[model samples]
Target: MFPPKLATATLFPLTLGLIAHFTIAQATLFIDSEHLPQAKQYDYIVVGAGPGGSVVASRLSQDPNINVLLLEAGPSDEGLLDIQVPYLAFDLEPNTVYDWNYTTTSQPGLGGRNILYPRGRVLGGSTSINLMVWTRSSRDDFDRYAMVSGDDGWSWNAIEPYYRKIEHVVPPVDHHNTTDEIDIGIHGTRGPVNITTANAPYPIDPHVNATSQELGNQYPYNRDMNSGNPLGIGWTQGTYGNGVRSSASSSYIHPFTSRPNLDVLVNATVTRVLRTGHDVETGLPIFSGVEVAQSKTSSVFAINAIKEVILSAGAINTPQLLLLSGIGSSSPLAALGINQTVDLPAVGQRLVDHLVVANQFAMAAPEDDLFEAIRRNETLFNELLVEWERNKQGVMTNGPANHIGWLRVPEDEQGWKEGEDPSSGPTSPHYEFLFAPGFASTVAGTPVPPTGYFMTIFTVLVSPSSSGSVTLASSSPFDPPIIDPAFLNTTFDTQVMRAAIRSAARFVSAHAWDGFVTGQAASFADVNLNSDEQVDAWVRSQASTIWHPTGTASMGRCEDKDSVVDPDLRVRGTKGLRVVDASVLPFIPAAHPQAVVYAFAERAADLIKLGRHLC
Candidate 1:
């Protein structure tokens, strides 16, 4: 096994280059069963090589005695150039090779239209295709999660160290070594994930400043969101080293690829968990590992987990796996003709995803339209690609929305105080406004603006009240689940979204945008902004997902009837089975969940190592 990561977070440019350069070379970390011994048992079997599973496998394999077998449903994250570039996340999202390409079941709230829901299908999972924004939920949310899970280990204080342990903060290029917008002590010197500022933060940071000024300090600005208070305008921090995307496969797995005990298998699609026996005491079904198949028609192979079978297949697939394995609610299992081993009715309930809406504003400076130059003109893009390949610098290395603003739903407009900001202070932002410069009109059916220079403010609901579910579409494990995150199902959620859109509209109208913004897009202008009802209607027609889904296989206190997993991440009625992904998050944090998932997996590794869930 490899030694612990060096105690220093400081890395010279040469060290950084070596790490990014050889990321794909570590694909040797994966081994097909064809080359393996006949022995099918391993000390620990981690399902999925996403952020959570990657961390667990790497850490558990640290002890040479512990053999870790990580199974990935997709191909290895080798030679995927889009997965390496920070900005290319947009390009990767629509591709089936990198994303699961799941869609919601026609939402009644969203004008009964089915929205495309992308999940990572490759080795690094969603991290390989995600926009790479890095930040955790509010501190209050973690504390609340602890309360719901009945475990102090789920508390912010309990998980903060893990956050620090897994983080290695890198400053933006030319910004020096100083923490630009990050708070002191709130970051780490050494951990697997690389957090750094984009080389170019979209050229519209001045607009962020002007918008904040127009707000008259009523909302003020947040200096650093990662430090517990995320309410304010700040430069977005991406999970990157210079410009190369720092995926879990790259950060956690690649760093320890030489570890003999850690074996990863790619292109192994798991069908379900296996139950070979039952616990003698509680009579809970004992997990015997999992069944894998090369394809839907391939012969099944059962791999035994000598110790435990941990599901890190993310929120969507984890619950599906449990239900398919006869470890879920009796009613659903009966319908599918699958015998129920566990009556956990809450396995696929309470699903949540961030509902986002975008407003397009016309930018007068046609010459300043960045997308036209890079997106349409292959010559310009090629030049930028050359710069990125050479030094990992330039606009090609920039994540889409670099200047982000976290705001609470302020209670004010036209001498009116709505008093509707429900979240706890600035530390817990309720809304997110992502500034995308030269990002007007839809290009290729995405939210991108038309083929010209236009600025856009994508308003997002960070803490939504509405919830949905992931249910079986059929009895077959190969069939996709019915995802119904019933976006804006509740009236309160609708009100919050209305407030968010209006607030974004106000920011666009700020005098600061006067010189650049000529007018609102005709699509937005067609709406009746004068009436609150029309604004709500407009939002209902246009809202889409921000791609953060959680809370399906939620962790909860014993009293919670809908809870599927306990605070220990073990299913309610099973032994030797645990979930270690976003599925276990009792509630979606105020920020993105990628960081939270990494941190929780660290705590999970410690808990498992210490035998916290011993039978």
Candidate 2:
């Protein structure tokens, strides 16, 4: 066993540096089973090395006495150059090695079209492929979950400290660090993950900023959204370190790669969670181990988790893995030729995600052409590349989707919060607008014919009312599960999005975008500006998802029979099994869930440690 000090988070960076520059292989354990010589057991086995799994494994292994085994189905994030650059996330998706690139079943609500769902198949999971924005959902989101789960301490105030605990905010340099522009009491200064705001130079689009201000002015309750209120136009803050993508791997996993007890097995596809008993009358199945097949060798192996089997395989994969292990709906298990051990009817229910639209507006630039920058800027490209290589700063470091705004549905809008509920009245939030500053377009087929230059506003409907589900594709572990978000299926969801879009269009007409719009930028020239039907029609055709899938295995009170996990994050009917990922959320947060998941996992770790201490 290694010393506890060597496993500390502060030492992680140095250990990772040693692995990257000086070491060949970090360390290896010998496992010589009769059928599978490579099969091994660990004190804690975390499936999927995404944000949640990475933190859990990294922190748990720090105890020195505990050995952590992290298994990822994707290839190693060794030399993915685009992964290092934030703007290049778009280009990296089509590459098979880096992204899972799964598509959902044809949505009945989305004109019967299958939406392309890109998930990071690399070490950091979606964080590697995702736009590196790091906004947390409003505090009400957590309180709502807590209320549903009947867990008192699960509220935002109870968990907000964890966000600060894991966060290490890197002060902005020059104009980029808008700390003065936004509030900081709610943010953190010292932590593991680095959070920074984008300051890449773009002419201050008056219309965009002015319109955003107007919306806030008109909706005074939402002014200063970034001040833990999240209700107006603002610059986007994200997990970018001097512009390079700071994914969970770069910030969490990679930093601990050299730890003696933390073992990571990449490209290992887990087949099933090994369980012993089937009859609940007798008892819940004892989670013995995980059966996995090596991607390179196609050889099956069984690895045991001596203490716990935590599923951080994400919303889709986590439920599917559980079902394969005989822990899901009875009907589906029987249909797929799998025996049902635990009839958890809600293993893959209550799915929710943010539906977004790439609102494209054409603009004549003052100097540099937009298409020219994406297609032909050799000098600019090379200069930015060299700058990043030398100093880790530039446009290359910023995500294509930078700058965000948060807003609430109008009082007249569907699902609008009617005068503070008599039972559950006034509430505070972190932020609501998920704004970005790149031209948003479809990625399903060959890219749309490019307009010369445009600044697209991707307004994410974060607090969506529509919910969907995931089901087995013939119970096969290898088969991709069927996911249908049923976007815009509800009148409440549709109306809320319509209000958001109209509000955004108003902002475009505002002064903030005046200097930015040199030419005609409106796409809907035919639609009458004042007509509600025209705006609603435009919204229906244009809206798409922001790709933040969650809530397949929600945490809830005992009364919620469909809930897969308890508020403590333990599998409802099973012992020694817990889920510590986005799937546990009862509802989608009003902001991005990256920071929320980190905070949730931290609280989970503390709870587990507390339970152990009592023992």
Candidate 3:
């Protein structure tokens, strides 16, 4: 259920509008499992409707002759107001029905705490519930992908056009002239997904921008971070326009739902991939179909794909589905009483994610606090909601932060194991800072203070050396996989985080925030930031994932023994099947992955269309 702050009457109309629009105009495009024909087949069967699957499915369906089926394990993203409004993003996760609500294995690094790992169980997947920060990452990140996968097609130069093809820069909700805020020439003006800067100005925005000027080149002002050079403080761009969240579903699927060739089934889970036959030439098992069911006990139905089965169930579920279909390590499958169809030992290995710690401080004045005030005062919150619903303006038009910075630690100063720096290149950011004008806690159920103004600076370790794995808890698809990100497992990762926290402390020390900041608040009040040991301890207790999980089913050279998928994103030792999603990224990008995923999927659609001829 949605929060009580939003009136049901206001939300009912939106729901009714969606229902009427879909059912009357495009009834054939959306199918319920109860009415789904048993022998129905399509040209392509896309497993998940995230950015990867949505792009692939939508692009493929553009050809009227090529029919597409996009399956989502969750409900539709029709009228979920919390998901629609940018400011209410934090309230839609953890234990909500819109989230997967999986918990990680206890980690010794975080005092044996089981972190809450939330994956969106909605139409747009994680993009439907994510914070919506759009970052293209560094140019070197894509070049590194090309290097690892032994394919020049994955290079930054080759993929830059795809980034342009995926973005459609729109006016901010406030309709402020974005003259100096963005670089218009670098962005795509007519793309599917909408991108924008902060809709309204925040009190902390100018201060953060001024700090970049005060700090000189160490913290420089980058007018545009998405220009393939994301290495400085700038306005945070998001996947939104006119105060509405522009998700993969909203951008790629919903607008195209009227297409007669595309059929999307919600609440339909693909239980496992099914091997149909063997290829005549390679003798590799041909996996051209999948078994889907609405529930564990419901009727199981096998759906075949004439062309290919594109797996885009994201990092966690993609690997889990592969293992369930007898395509993982032999020893693990033998223990689970499952047959090993393909002895691919690296199916679920190399899981990577970014760790963020929130550093909070009490604000000097209460009147400047808008977020905390909205959280505490129901009347103000409702008023803001009405303002957003009537006209896309006010704080609800934007997210928690207006500005963000991506910086790298000086190479000579840091401690490196065997002198190997984990970053892709000199331009890649090692850490990031997200400036929030109000109290922000990553931990679930943290209550907002009853009466005080606060600000939080999120210190994120973007370039983590530590890696983890996603393994099967059991053979049953109903059971969730054991997701162990292994956060701060290595000293290198912790060292980077410690540097990020110190950097945040130094950033606020600038004269721009002299009267704005009073002192450290909450957990930081007792701990001394000057002591290295204390800061490390505080990080261990506060660190949590930003929910950008990738690389569980990584891409590599075709002959590479450890790689799960080849350069073409085709599953190794399998024919007529490919894995597209965050799972196929060989290395996690040094920024938010939604924009990267969108670009990767755009390129993947071309590869799928051109087949092996894509150079």
> In model 3, which regions exceed 4 Å deviation?
1-31, 37-40, 613-615
How high is the CA lDDT of each candidate model? 0.77, 0.67, 0.86
Residue 581 Cα positional deviation in candidate 2, in Å, after optimal superposition: 0.5
List TM-score per model, in order: 0.91, 0.87, 0.96
Report the lDDT tens digits of candidate 3 across residue range 414-453: 8767666688997799999998878877665666666668
Clashes of each: 11, 24, 0
Q: Name the best candidate (by lDDT).
A: 3
Superior candidate under TM-score, 1 versus 2: 1
In candidate 3, clashing pairs total 0
The ten-residue window of minimal lDDT in model 3 covers: 1-10
Displacement of residue 312 (Cα, Å) in model 2 is 0.3
lDDT of 2 at 50: 81
lDDT of 1 by residue, 269-313 (tens): 899999978889888789967999867887888888888999999
Model 3 / residue 182 / CA error / Å: 0.7
Return the lDDT, model 3, position 127. 94
